[model samples]
Target: MFRVIVRSSISLAAFAAGFPLSAAEAANAAATSEEDSIVVTATRAPLALDEVPSTITVLDKAAIDRSQDIGATELLLRTPGITVSRNGGYGTTTSLRIRGAESDHTVVVIDGVKLNDPAASGGGYNFGHLLVGDMERIEVLRGPQSILWGSQAIGGVVNIVTTIPEKPLEGSFDIEAGSRNTVSARAAIGGRTGPLSWRIGGQSFTTDGISAISPAFGGVERDGYRNRGVTGRAELALASNFSVEVRGYYSKARVNLDSTRADTPDYAFNQEFLGYAGARLDLLDGRFRNRISYSYTATERENYGPLRARPVSLEARGENRRWEYQGNIGLMRGVSAVFGAENERSQFRSRSPDASLARPLPPFANGKAEVTSVYGQISVEPVDGLTINGGVRYDDHDRFGGQTLFAAGGVWRLPTGTILRTNYGEGFKAPTLYQMFSQYGNAALDPEEAHGWEAGIEQHLFGRALTVVATWFDRTTTNQIVYTPDATCNAASTNPLCFEPGSTTVRTAYYLNVARGKAQGIEAAAALTLGALTLDGNYSWIVTEDRSPGGANFDKDLPRRPRHAANASVSYALPFGLDIGAALRWSHKSFDDAPNSIVLDAYTLVDLRAESKLSENVRLFARAENVFDEQYMTAYRYGTLGRAIYAGFRGRF
Candidate 1:
């Protein structure tokens, strides 16, 4: 099944690439305009993209609709300066690594709410299974955002903004089928009457994946995944000074994981369900804007495999719920301010239902966390063409205790159509439940903290026909955790459990107060317009050094991070209403192991997309991904899907 999907995806890419280019001849001219492009919500409000000082990328609706895959992670591949790492194959928990930052350090938000699992050990939000077809836009903010977004904003942020209806009774529905017996359906509806507006959407997808790979030590085989969900939202204009918008979304998905090295006969099933509700309000004579949000997430996991003949299995279930409220107040004209307070409470419970374990008859672990934070940001323009931004935040965590963050930055417009910017900030990440109390006996684990800054310049040429930006940054982190070997275990122990007694393993892994690391990098991105054609590309180079715990190793490469990565795309739109695009994404493979002992080969993927307006209200579209069918592994010891294709119809009324 997986093989078939790969083939179809390749075919689709070929067709899109081979489509007649003559139709786009009109728009192929080098003249273009960027004055009307929306800035982005990354600034906490709408601003022109060129006006914002930081590195930001916005995937507009057209780009979203034309992308080959509807999955959030897959769509992100189209963006520059961002990388999505999948655990194994498609539909798995796709992890993201941004600017050499760990997966958990990057925050993901939908609407105005954060989406991390407080109950999970890693405290990372998986983008792999997120649906993308129903979204209006996706914004990627690179660099540190702790001052603007609070904790866990070390690497960057990805904000998925949904579509809002512009008229009464607006809706769109799409159904597509291709290889792997894959089938998907998505629909959205929205309307407005008087002072009220609302929108709702739902999606369902399923696929029987390819045959398993090697290192098969488990009993399960066959790769398969399924998902379904719905989202509803409404906005109310209460009065001239007060308005509100509320939204809620829920989704559930199950995945089959390859646990063994060789197409193992065994597979693990991971199930997840998440929902969020949030509201926005305008207040204080149009000077203040407030938002309140809450979210709930739950997961049930079971691992089926073999432990030396006796059926080995693991089962666990957990949930996380949180609430946040914040407000931004604009005052003193060129001086706009933002302030907010939030509280989050979460609980987790996990039990081993497997009778194979010595103490399998009970729930072994349970934990909870309560967190609170207060933050504020101010933007000031002291002089014409000169803007300054500064902010600070304080947070209290039930586990790791407390921490503070501060930031300051400025942007100056040069006389020759060039912009110069610089910024410095501090960030932190609290240890999750797993790090604190999971099977490991680490009752003490401090939060990871860091300080960093960057300087950059942007240039506009040919009367905005071309744009260029370059930046250099350095960051250092400390209080890193290191695991050391315990000294009490021996094979002669009579007790059934003595921290690896039977294996003569007295070593226990615990979070230590030792370990430190530093990272430095340079990045450049550019966009050039020629007639009706546009070319966009970005490149990054990084150097990382780390000191492991127990003096075992120091100055080693950070895990799973590459020294260089790049992306490029070329798009053209014709006057007759036909559009075509092609893109190339490449990553220099790094290592999955801590000491850089293991190596994953680098890979490049080619994707193609096209759309033609059959009429004013209707259009035909198609896309091909991984056109080369390159054999690759995104993670250490895992295999990625080969190729895939998708095509469908779209319309508006």
Candidate 2:
């Protein structure tokens, strides 16, 4: 068992008032990049989309405002090469997959701080609580990007940049009410004064939600959900070439849960806290920049069963503390380098109380691990209209020894507005604490590893009024960790733990690296704008399968990973200061379990939206989601949201 230093963690989290100024600035530039062609997430450096060999999607504030979506996951679903599965309406357990990769393989970063819960089943962030409040930008970089993002980027990286004050004094507010007795309110205020820049935001949301278990499965109850969160960031310019920053985020949520067998008074509450502190230094006419930082994150979860002797059924906590030093340098006219070194400490503890047992619960299943890493990347433009980049990273885990990853990519833009690109990348992922040390854990598991490559082309026509891109990618993962069930264990099990976690009773199985998986896909996207009308769409054909030789589930489809998905939206601005839009989303059938015994059928959904400019700084908007009231399932026997309507107004000053 390991002990956690709560006070030290809090102090470290407060080191920086919030987000680093330098990284924030780079992300801001990504949002306003010329014609949305420039991106920063690809290499943590500003580069035009045409020069980025990897696939990426950027959503600026205007695009976010145009969608008028309440949650972050909802908005992200509109992007390409992504999928989401929610157990029920808002605040339920949620998973997001990119390019058919495991949900935990993706890395989520907010304002330069990585987010994950070491105690969770897969040690991943739950999309349920990521709301679209007081955020200005979102970037989705797809592929196995471990070279620059470290081990967790086996799938990709989702970088969320929050609002930063650009004016002397500015504020924004959003208020809305919707079907299912849902209501939401959010507000933010920030400004720059002298050498200090700061921002603060808060949000409140609640809803009488649908049953967690599908009604088709005999569910019958009106579950409810509630959430509250706050974010704060501040930066101080201590000198002309040096500045310090600090950022913090906190959220609390209550989600109603039920059993598929029947409706019951069961629920779970979750809390998350993130803190960061950093300082930046610039030299040599700003050509050389450096940042030193520290960050801390903690997640707490509790489940309740009212009928049980002890209402508290489960309690768990996870913490991550990190320190880093990064440097960016421009060596020559077309050569630049990004180098960084970082160390992270991750810890988790969990416990469950039994109503049947009169004795108290056993000691918490607690464990801790640490990893140190260093990475270097170089970008160069060897010839006109062409750019190439390569990167390498090395990580040393306390127990797992060491691992190395490499990536390379290149992009060429011709005079005819044609772009060609290709990329190759590798990834590494160490097992989670719960997967290696808990009762159901097997400490002998090996780290998961992956490699992937992609080739793509882009064509622009009509004076850049229309753009289209197509890409094909393939990936292979070995020694992937998976869950296994072994009802019999006499302390004589040969191989155990196959993953998923959070049970306190006698262990039947444990986590182990036993599976090999592969995925291949094609992605196509298009965007067109003519006069006051705009249209954009994307389609993805991804096939994920278990390829382990002689394995029981060999060639079976990965659970919840659809083979096909598409999204399209069209909008037009009317001369009367009103805008109308429509969206269509479709997903193909997928397996519900590893054995592929259960099947989930395909489904389609449509939504209608309209917004009117009330004034230069305010707008009124409304949307009808799931207009056809389509009934479907992303998870076996779990309910999916039906038709719902929402109306709201947003203002900025």
TM-score of each: 0.86, 0.94
Best by lDDT: 2
Model 1 score (lDDT): 0.66
TM-score of model number 2: 0.94
Expressed as tens digits, the lDDT of each residue in 1-653 for candidate 1 is 00001001111010011010011110121112344333434456433344456666666565667664668886665554456667665566577866777777788877555667644556777776788757766767777787666667788887776666656788987777666777888888888777777789898988876544422233235577788878776766666545555566677676666653655545455566556655556667656767676666676665665442435455656676777676767788678776777777766655445434554354456667777888887888888788788888888887767778888888887779888888888888777665565554355567888788888888889986887878888877787654544455455654333342123334344455577877789888787878888888878887766754455557778777778888788888899998898888888988776767878779898888888899887788777778998877666656676677877777766
Q: Model 2, residue 185: what's the lDDT?
A: 97
Residue 490 lDDT in model 1? 58
Per-candidate local distance difference test: 0.66, 0.83
The RMSD (Cα, Å) of candidate 1 is: 8.0
